[model samples]
Target chain A: MGSVFTPRNLLVAGGFILIALGIWSGEAGIVFEKAIRVCLECIGLG
Target chain B: MTRTPKIINRLIIQVAALFAYNPFLHNFLTGELYRGGSKYLCTPGLNCYSCPAAAASCPVGSLQAVLSGRNTITSTYVVGFLLLYGALFGRFICGYLCPFGLYQEALYRIPGRKLIPSRKVQMLGLLRYPIFFLLVVGAPLLVVDTFGNGTAGFCAWICPAGTLEAGIPLMLTQQSLRSLAGILFQWKLFVLILLSALSVVLYRPFCRFLCPLGLIYGWFNRISLHQIKIDSSRCTTCGACVSSCKLQISIHTNPGSSECIRCGDCARACPHGAISIGFDIPTSQARTVTRN
Candidate 1:
């Protein structure tokens, strides 16, 4: 079995940390704000 | 005749795509777009945030939005979500969850002469990296409006998935949107139509050539926890798997190639049962097996 501290595993752990930080820092809320409103430019209407 | 394992997998994945978009059942009945808190989360596939039934944000769209926004705070939410998915499943999401990918497969199933991509066509898969770099990241970061806000270049200019999933539905349902339709909408519609028609003959043309998300996830396929493994001890170089692969990959040599979506078609096609899809095995084992 591969060690738990393998580089890949570490990267995965880092990914989780990043996600947590993003949420805690309200970055997720920013994404939600953008996502809730339909950006007409995104669908190419503008 | 019984359905093949590949068919079963596709069916399960199609249902997953449906559930991913319609997580909030109420949105289906109301036909009103979900604007709930769950929209903050990003799905593992190419679902459009603008999709009326979508319960989550699109990672690609969110990444572009963040890059374009003038906000000094650089959030890693999109990157983290994408990295997490890529590191775990890689292109498996493309094969098993993306609604657009399922759409392409459904179109290919139609009664028509399927276009077998040539070696040159397969090489075109490399083009997606540049697209990811330029359209998804670079353009959004570099090109700014008069107010210094960047544009969501890929979503605004290139994403056919967004056009199909969001634009058409919104247009059909909202009378007010009809008056706002202009040249940009027409251009997107034209692109969507062209891609839809192309999908009937080509196997996942967008995934193969255009999807930036695919390009990003594919980079991790070689190291992803869930991956396709080839056991050379049971293998014959019969070339059966290659013919079976829609992505035109050589399974024995490069099972984890970025173009591979982990659809398991190659594994199912292998008469020798040499190819296996599983979790928690390092790709080094596959290399060792092939060398022996």
Candidate 2:
């Protein structure tokens, strides 16, 4: 109950919101996947 | 951890997810709010792909294919989601979002041993690295066809999630797939059954050792914007928090260890109210430190 809206919560909540928005807007799993692709592209790992 | 809230939260999600057959709810907000294409949004701990309501993709399954990528970069999306989830949630995603984690908890309820501690347990934890590198990463490259679309290694060969979601459903619908099932399918089913059995005695065995997503998320626990704070002045060091930890942590010994999921159990456990969850880099706290 105490400090339920800490940064971690906000980040997670934001991540979930982005995901929902992506799907509802017809972009399935786009947020997480976009980040992954960007990272992999950066590292040349993908 | 008492696990009541965790269990109840999972139960509620399961009921809502299963409402696919609940025609009454289908006409209302629950159906529209909780149905297909969105599972890629919510990361249920269970890997319950069969559940009617799922938004986000199965991260592990995605990684397995991407790692064992054949044609296109399969893991690109999976890795992105994982990093975001990890950076955002730290390890709480395992507690609140993973469908597989929920399933493991349900299996663990009929417990006998409750926990088994060992060096082997620690050793087993290391296996994830190789699993992440090879199955999650390596095999896909080797096995993928000329076009390059790789098989979802862990899911195709070993993932419990596929069995829970795709495997069970495909068998139920297609008689031929049930007949087409062979040693590999049986092997995964066996693993699922064994993990389910182990859950009664062990807490989150998969999360501890096998899950690639858990591994990915755990890496960010230490540096995530939010952190579990241990006020040394208020702490008694009685180690009550350590004993209460189901994740095999000693909060007094290492309050900010990577194993922490930031579920706030230690905070809840401390009678002295020594623990609090906060963003480690608050502007005010940062400024104070800078001044000091």
Candidate 3:
């Protein structure tokens, strides 16, 4: 069996840390702000 | 005749994922995009955020928006979301979850002479890397307006999913928006139509040749928690898996190929039951499997 410290597990850990950082740093709110408004550009209007 | 277990399972997941991404059915009728809390969260698949019924944000759209924003603070949420998903499931998102992926498959299922792409044509798959870098990352970060904010160039200029899921629907419902259809809309419509036509003759032409999201997820196929294992002890190299795969990859030689969408087709096709898909510690024999 492979060790617990496999690259997959390490990357997974890194992902969680970044997610935590994003949530704490208000990045989720930024994403929410963009998502709530309908950008004409996104729909190919602009 | 009953559908194979892989097909049945994939269909179930894809359907469930579709509903999960766009649960607000009433919005479709109202011709208004969903503005719910779920919009804060990104869907694993390439569902459009502006899609009338979409309840969640699209990762690519979100990524571009974040990149183009004037704010100096780089957002980690989208990156983390993608990384976590990639590490956990890889291109399984493309095979079994993406609404756009499902759309391509449905298009392919239409009655027609399915065409296998030539190896030279298959080289088009390399376009996704440049697309991901230039359109998704570079353009949004580099090209800014007078206000110092850049545009989501990929969504604005390309992205047939947005055009199909949001543009056409919105235009149909809102009479005012119909007047806004110009060169860009025309170009997008043309792309959507052309791809739709190609999809009838070719299996998942978009997923195979385009789709930056698939490009991202594919990078993690070698190390994802979920894996496809070929048990050497039970194996006869009869080439069943490769023949069964629509992606046309040699699974026995390289089970962790980036081209593999993890649809579990190969596992079902293995007559000897040598192939399996799940989370497990790699054994001594399985370690010999090569990565692409």
**1 versus 3: better TM-score goes to:** 3
Q: What would the per-residue lDDT of candidate 1 be over residues B1-292, giving only the tens digit for each residue?
A: 1112476866787777868675765553444678888988898888888888888898889888777777633558788888788888888888888888888888888887989887887788788877888878887788888887887778888899889878887787777887799999999888888888999999999998889999888888988887777878998899999988877788789978888887878888888888888565557566656887
My TM-score estimates for the predictions, one after another, are: 0.91, 0.71, 0.92
Cα lDDT tens digits, model 3, B1-292, are: 1113467878899999999888887887778877778888988899888888998899999888888888843668889989999998898899888988888889888987888888899999999988888888988888899998887878887798999889888888888889878998998888889888998889888888878999999999988977887779877999999898888899898989999998888888888988888664456336545431
Candidate 3, B79: how far from true, in Å?
A: 0.4
lDDT tens digits, residues B124-197, model 2? 87878887777767676666767765554555556776576546544555565567666776777788788777
Using TM-score as the measure, the top candidate is: 3
lDDT of all predictions, in order shown? 0.81, 0.57, 0.84
TM-score of chain A of each: 0.78, 0.54, 0.81
Interface DockQ of each model:
0.71, 0.09, 0.75
What DockQ does model 3 achieve?
Answer: 0.75
Model 3 ranges off by over 4 Å: B1-5, B281-292
Candidates arranged by DockQ, highest first: 3, 1, 2
lDDT of 1 at B221: 91
